[model samples]
Target: MKYFLWLLVSVALAGSISSCRSTKRIQTAISKKDTAAVVPVVDAKADSMRFIHEIYQAIERNRIDFNTFSAKLKVDFSGDEGKKRDFTAVLRIKKDSAIWVSITALLGIEAFRIMVTPDSVKVLNKLDKVIQLRSVSYLQELAKVPFTFQELQALLIGNPVFLDSNIVSYRKNEKTISLLSATDIFKHLLTVSTDDYRLLHSKLDDVDVLRARTCNIVYGDYVNKNALLFPTYRGITVSEKTKVDIVMQFKQVDFNVDLTFPFNIPRNYKRQ
Candidate 1:
C-alpha cells in the first residue's frame, strides 16, 4: 500500500514552473495588431511580439486567481508495476498556502492522505498505519527534478507551468502555435490552440544526448468555470529511467467556497 499511495503523490505533483524580458517593442507590436496585415506578415519583430502576446494572453486566460479550490477526481494510473488501477481522490487547496488530498481505494476505503504546504509535507499512510513528515525538498526527491509547491498548484488548476518567457522565435500554423527555449539541461517546447489560445501540450527533453529523458503533458476538454475556462481532463507522461502515465478527470470542482482541511494521525500510528 505504500507503493500504491506513493504513486498518487508522485504523479499528482512532479513538475515545476520556469521563468521570462523585453517590453517596449513587444508592447508596440501588440498595440499595432489592429493595423497589421492579416496575411502572415513577414516582419520578424512584429511576428515575434505577436507570438509572445498570444502566449502571454493565453497564460493570463488560463490563470486561476481563486482563494481556494476543491475538486473531486477520477484518476487512472498506469506504468506502475505494469498494472493499471483506478482511484477516487478529493483535492482541496488554498492559494499559496497548502494542498490537501485524500485518496479512497476499493469500497470507498480511505487509504492515504497528503498535506503539503510551502515549508513541509506530511503523508498519512493508513494501510501501514505510519506517517512521514518531510520538507519541501520531498517533491524534488520524488520526481528526480527540481519542483516547487506553487508550480504543482498551478498545474493542478490548469494554468501554464514551466514556461520560459525568453522565447524569441516561434512556429505558427493554422491550428497551433509553438514556443521553444533551451536551458543548460533541457529543451522545452510548448504548444497552444490558435483558436482560443488554450494550452494543447508541453514537452521537455534533456539536452545531453547521452541522457535520454522526456516529460509531456496534454490538456483537453476545456470547460468554463465562472467566466474562466479550464481543462476538465489532463494526461501527463514522464519518461526517464522508466515511464509513468497518469490520467486525471475532474468530475466536479468548486472555487472560493467555505472549506476545512482536516489531518489527524492516530496515537497508535508509527512514524517513519
Candidate 2:
C-alpha cells in the first residue's frame, strides 16, 4: 500500500511536470504597434525609457511558480588553449519551495539526481547504483554547483542573476545604471542599458591578478508562455588576458510544473 502511494505521487509530479510558457502575451507586449508608436516621438529616449521600465516592472511585478525546468548545457573553460573540454548534458529542476525539490542531470551513460528538502538531501547515481542522503546544511558544503540556491532561483525566474544581491551597489543615469557587487569570493560591475534594461556589460575584478576582466553574457531568444519569459540561448565570454567562451542552447523548458518528493525506494535499488 505504501509503495503504491509513493508511485501515485511521483507520477503526478513527474508527468507533465513539464510545460511550456505562453508566447501569445509576449507578442502582445512587443507588438509591431508598440514599436511603430515610438518612431515619431521627440523625447524618444524618454519614451523608450518609460516603455522599458514598464516592461521590466511587469517582469518584476509578475510572480513565477517555476516548479520544474529543463536545460541543456555546454561548459568549457579556457585557461589553456591546447585542449577543449566539453560535454552535453540535460538537467531537470523540480522545486516545491525555496528549500525543497529535485535536480536530475542526465549525461552520457550516467544519471545523477539530487533531492533536497528543508531537512535533507539525497544524491542518486544510477551508473553506480548508489544513493547517498545527508542533512541539508551539510550537503550545502558538499554541493559543487557553480552558484548557490539563491542564484539559481534568480536565473530560473528570468531575473538579473547576481551571486550576492545584499551587498550590491547601483548608480543610475538617464541611459544606464552601473551596479557593483563585491565579496571576498569575487567582485563585478554590471551596466544595464536603460532603454533596453539589457545588461550591456559586466566586469569582474580579479584580486589575485590585480586586474579586471569584462564578462559578456548575452541573451539570444526569449519564449513567453503563461505570463513568463524564458531565455532559450545563452552565451558568455570571460575576458582576462586570454578569452574563454561558453554557449548554452536550450532545447525546451517547462515552468510552474508539478514537483513532488518520492517517499519510497524500489526494492532493486541500493540505498546507502
Candidate 3:
C-alpha cells in the first residue's frame, strides 16, 4: 500500500522520428540544375531562434490559471513485479497551498487518504489503521529529484515541469512540435500541439551519465472547461532499476470551485 502512495506521487511527477529520402535521379537532376542556379543560403540559426520564441509565447498563452482544482479519476497502476491495481481517486488542490487525495478500493471502500502541504506530508492507511507523517523532503528522497509542492501542483494541473530555457533543438511536423532542452538535472523533451500548443507529451531523462532514470508522460483527451484546455487522460511511466506504469482518466473535473479537505486521524490508528 505504501508503494501505491509512491506511485501516486510519481504519477503526478511523470516522441517519434521521421526520415525523408530523395531519389537518386532527382538528386542528380537537382545537382546538375543547381550548378548554374545560386541556392539561397538559409540562416538556420536565426530561424531556429525565432521558432523557439514562438513556442515559448504559445506555451505562455495556453497556460492554465486557476484558484482551486478538483477531480475524480480512475487510476490503473502496474509495477515491475507484474502487480496491477485499479482504483478510484478523488483529488482536490488549493493552488500553492494543499493537496488532498482519497483513494477508494473495490465497492468504493476508502483505502487511503493523503494530504500534502508545502512543508509536510501525511498519509492515513485505513486498511492498516496506520498513519505516516514525514517532512516534504521525504518526497524528494522517494522521487530522487528535488521535489516540491509547487512541482506536484503543476504536475496534477497538467502544466509543464522541468522545462528549461536553453532549448537545444526542436522538431516540427504538421501535427506536433517537439522541443528538447538540457539542464543540469534533466534532459526534457516536450511535445505540444501545432494548433494551440497544448501539451501532448513530455519525456525526462537524468542528466547524470551513469543514472538510468527516465520518465514519460502523455496528455490527451483535452476538454475546454471555463475556457481552459484541460487534459482528462494522462499516461505515465517511470523507470529506473524497475518500471512502474500508471494511467489516469478523469471522470469529472472542475476548476475554481469551493472545496473542503476533511482529514482526521482515527484514535485507534497507530502512528508510523
CA-only RMSD, every prediction = 9.9, 12.8, 9.7
Better of 1 and 3 by TM-score: 3
Off by over 4 Å in 2: 1-90, 94-110, 117-121, 134-147, 163-177, 183-185, 196-218, 236-246, 259-272
TM-score of 3: 0.86
In every candidate, how many clashes are there? Answer: 2, 4, 0
Best prediction by TM-score: 3
Name the lDDT of candidate 1.
0.68
- Tens digits of lDDT, candidate 3, 103-198: 888888999999999999999999999999999988887887888888888888888877667877777779988777767777777779898899
Expressed as tens digits, the lDDT of each residue in 1-272 for candidate 2 is: 11111111111100000122222221132222322112222231555456445544543444355666655554332332644444454555665333322323344453555554546656665666777666645433432213344444444344455434423344456876555556654455444555545433333444344434334444446677666656565444444455444444565566656645453445566777
Question: In model 1, which regions exceed 4 Å deviation?
Answer: 1-46
RMSD (CA, Å), candidate 1 to true, equals: 9.9
C-alpha lDDT score of every prediction, in listed order = 0.68, 0.43, 0.75
By descending TM-score, how would the candidates be arranged? 3, 1, 2
Report clash pairs, candidate 1. 17-162, 18-162
Higher-TM-score candidate of 1 and 2: 1
What is the overall TM-score of model 2 with all chains considered together?
0.51
Name the 10 consecutive residues with the lowest summed lDDT in model 3: 17-26
How far off is residue 57 in model 3, in Å? 1.9
Q: Per-candidate TM vs. native? A: 0.82, 0.51, 0.86
lDDT by residue for model 1 over 1-272, one digit each (tens)? Answer: 44433443354321211100111211122122211112233233775787677676676766778889899988766663677777889999999998999989788889989888988888899988999999988776776666778777888888877676766456677887766655665666666777777777666676665656666566777778877777877776665667666667886888889889999989999999
